[model samples]
Target: MKKQILTTLVFLGIIIPAITAQTTSENPYADSYIYWDYLAAYKSGQATVAFNNIDAMLQTYPPQKEIAMPRELALVSLDQLLHDTDNDQTETFYTFINTRMMRVLKDLDRPVEKGLRIYKLYNDGFIIKSKKATVAIDLIPGGSNAKPFIKDSIIYGIAGKCDALFISHWHADHANLNIAKSFAARGKRVIAPKGLWENVDPMIQPLTEHIETDIKFDDLDLTLHVLPGHQGDVLNNINVVEFHGEGTVAQTGDQWGTDDLKWIDHVNEKYDIDVLMPNCWINNMKRHLVGFGPKMIITGHENELGEHSIDHREAYWMTIKKMELLSDLNMPYVLMTWGEWYDYQR
Candidate 1:
C-alpha cells in the first residue's frame, strides 16, 4: 500500500504539471494556441476568426524567436491555402494583412525620442525617426498581388507622421502610389529615382536626379545622397540619409551589387554608414559589407509575402544561418520583424 500510494503520487505530479504547462499562458508554447487556432479557422472557412487569431498572437508579444518562427510558418501555410483552388476563402488573407497594417500604424503613432528610432514595416519598408525628421522608405503592403491590403486611412495616418517618402525602386512590393500621394498631398517630399509613377500620374513624379547629387530636405534638416544601383535589370536607388546631428544610415533596396561595385565602392569612400539596411538574400553580402563597412547591420526583406515562391520567402532561421556565415566579418547585425523598432544612439 505504501509503494502503491507513492507510485500514484508520482504519476499525478507528472500529469498535473504536464497539463498545466499545456494550458498555462506562461508556458513558452502558449503562443501556439494562436497558431493552431488560426489554422483551424482557415480550414473552417472562417476568415474573421483566423484574423482574430493572428491579432491575438501579435498582441501576446511572444519571445522574438518564438513569434518569428511560428508566425512565418503560419503565413506560408496561409499563402498555400489562399492559392489552393478548392479553398475559395481568400478574404482572410487580406484580413490578415490589413489587421497587421493597422497594428503597425498604431505603433508608429507612439511617441519617440529625439534620438534615432527605426521601425521595420512590410518587406523592405522602414520608418526612421530622428529629432529633426521622420523619414519613410519603401512603405508598402506585402504580398505578390498588386491589390492594396492596407486601407487609405491607415496610409494617410502613416504619411501624416512622415516628412518624406524615399522609394528605392518602382517595384509594387516596395512602392505605393497611395502612400506617395498622401505625402505629396501634405506638400512633403517624395524622392525616388527616375521613371517612378511616370505613367501613373503627372503630380506623382518623384524628384528624380542623378545618383551623385545630394537632395536636401530643409524642413526635416536632412540630406539624402541617392546612389545609382540596380535590382536585376531595373534601376534601384541606394539611399544614404544624413540626419542633422545623428549619423548617416544607408538602405539598399534589393540591390545585388552587380553594377561592378560602382555605387557600393563610392558610398564606402564618401560616407560612414551608421546602420546598413540590406536585403537578407543579397548575394556576396560579406564582400559588400566589407567594402561599404557599416558600423552595424539590420537585415530586411525577410518573408516577403508578395512572392509566391518559397525560395524568396525567407525565414528567421535562414537569416540566423546567414549571419553565422558572415560572423567572420566582425560586424554586429540585428534581425527585426514587422512593427518592431530598434533604437540607435550616435
Candidate 2:
C-alpha cells in the first residue's frame, strides 16, 4: 500500500505542474491582460471591440506603454501569418488581414506624448514630428532620393509625439502635391528650409512655417536651429534638433559641408547626441562623426525601391560595410533607415 501511495504521489507531482503550465500558456490574459484581450478582438475582426479597447488603453496607460505593447504583439502575429503563408498553409484572406493589421500597428507608433517615432513614408518625403512640431521634407523621389520615405516618417514621428518636423528641400520626390494638401487638412504644421515653402503646393501653404536660423522654445525642452551646408559645393539646408530633457538627435538632411560640421561641433560641445540621422552626402560619414560624436548614426535615402528612377536600397548596408572597414561597428553606433520603420529591432 505504501509503495502504491509513493508512485501515485510522484505521478501527481508531474501531472500537476504540467497542468499548471498549460493553464499559464492558455491564460493569454495573464499579466498583459489588456493587450492580449485587444489582440483577440483584432484577430476576431471585431472593429468596434478593437477601437473601444484601444481607446480604453489610451486612457489607461501612457502613450508609449499603450502603443508599444500592441504594436509589438501585432507584429508578432503578422510575422506568424507571413510564415504560414510562405509555407503555403495559410489562405489569402489570412495574409491580407495580417498585412492590414501590420499597417495599423505601424501607425500607432507615431510621436505621441513625447515619444519619438520615425516611419518611411512613400518614396522620399517624410514628416518629422516632436511634441508639438512637425516638419515635412521633400526629397527628389526617384530611387535614392529622400521624399516619400519622409511622408510616412512624418506621421510616425508625430504619432510618437515628437515636437517638430524638418523638410530638407523642395525636390519633387521629397514633396507631393496631394499629400501636402492632406497634411494641411489635418492641421499639421511644418518647418522647412528657406526655399522649401515657395515650392510647396498652395494647398499646404498654410501649414508651412519657416524656421529661423536659430529658434528657441523654452517650453519645448528643446531647441530648433537651422544649419546651412553645401553638398559637394552645392548649398543644401539642414535642421539641427537638440533635445535637452535627456537625449539629442541631429538631422543633417541633404546638407554636408564645413559649415554644417561646425554646427555639429557646437552640438557636441553643448550636448551629447544620442543619434545622428543624415543623408549620404558625398560619403563624408567620417567627418560628421568626428564633429558630432553621436552614439548612433541612422542614414536616410538608402533603401532601394525597384521600379523607381533612383533607389538607395543598399545605401544603408553599403554605408555599414564602409563603416566596418573603418571600424568594426555593427549596431546602435552605426544605423540606417530601412522602411516605415527600422527592421533591425524587428
Candidate 3:
C-alpha cells in the first residue's frame, strides 16, 4: 500500500505539471517562464532566441489590448539590446533582419485572394496586394549600412510577386537599388523620381516621370497617381494607388506637414483613400491625417535600426502616444510591427 501510494503521487506530480506546461505554452502571456526566458535571452544578447520568445508569445495572436504590455516590453528590450554598440553590430543587425524582417518576407509569400492586404516590411517599406495586382512601395531590407542584413535572393522573391514598384524617394532606407533592379528585371514597371540612382549604377536607373502624372497599367488593372510631395526640402513622391473594385491606399514616405498640403488636400478631395500608410514620427501627423481623411491610418517607420541617434530610434510606445493624441479624430489607426499585416475591404 505504501509503494502504491508513492507511485500515484509521482504520477500526479509529473503528469499534472506536464499538462500545465502544455497549456501555458499555448498561452505564452500566462507562462511567466516563457516571458522571463525571453527577457533573459534578450539581455544576454541572444537576439535570435529572444525573438523566438516574441514569436512564441505572438503565436496565439492575442488581442492588441491583451498583448500590449508584453509587446511594448519586448520592443523596449530589443531597442536597448540594439543600442549596446559594444556588442557585435553585424550580429545584431542580422539578428534583427533575420528574425523580424524575414518573418515579414515570409508572410508576404502568401496570396491575397480578395480585398486589399498591406504588409509592413520595415520602416515605410510596404507590399500592398489586391486581386488586381501586387504593388511594392519603398521595399527595402533594413537600412543603409555597409553590411547587408537581407540577401538579394530575398528581394527577388518579393519582386517575383509584384507587378509594379513605386519608390518614394532616394533615401537609402526608403529605396533600394537592388530591389528596384529586381522588379525591373522581372519585366515589371519601376516608377520613381528622376535621379534616384544617377551616380550609383546606370543600369538600375528607374523610369522617371512627372510627379503629378497618373501612370496607368491596364494589364495589371492598376492606376497610380504620383503626387508631388517633399520630406523637408527634399523631393518625395507621395503615391496614391487605386486597386479597382477593392479600395485605394496612399503611402506618404517621410512627407512632412503643410509644405505639401496643397497637393495632399487636392488628392484627398479627388480620391477616397481607404487606407493611409505614413511614418509614425512625422511632424504634425495629425494634421496630415486630417487633410487626407483616410478611412484608416497605419503608421510605419518605428524603430528604424539603421539610424545612429537614439532619438531617431522610434519605439512602440511613441506610436501609442501618437495614436492617443489622434484618438479624438474619429478615425481608426493600427500600429503594426514588421511581419504583421492589415486587411481593408470596400
Residue 331 lDDT in candidate 1 = 86
Q: Model 3 over residues 201-232: C-alpha lDDT tens digits?
A: 44344446535868788988879888878887
- Which is better, 1 or 3, measured by TM-score? 3
TM-score of each: 0.73, 0.51, 0.78
Task: Using lDDT as the measure, name the better of candidate 2 and candidate 3.
Answer: 3
Better of 1 and 2 by lDDT: 1
By lDDT, the best candidate is 3
Query: Considering lDDT, where higher is better, how would the candidates rank from best to worst?
Result: 3, 1, 2
Clash pairs detected, candidate 1: 143-306, 144-306
Local distance difference test scores for all models: 0.71, 0.46, 0.72
- Provide the lowest-lDDT 10-residue window in model 3: 58-67
- C-alpha RMSD by candidate, in order: 10.0, 14.2, 10.0
Q: lDDT for model 3, on a 0 to 1 scale?
A: 0.72
TM-score preference between candidates 2 and 3, better one: 3
Candidate 1 vs. true structure, TM-score: 0.73
| Clashes found in each candidate (C-alpha, N, C closer than 3 A) | 2, 52, 0
The superposed Cα distance between candidate 2 and the true structure at residue 150, in angstroms, equals 11
Off by over 4 Å in 1: 1-96, 143-147, 199-209
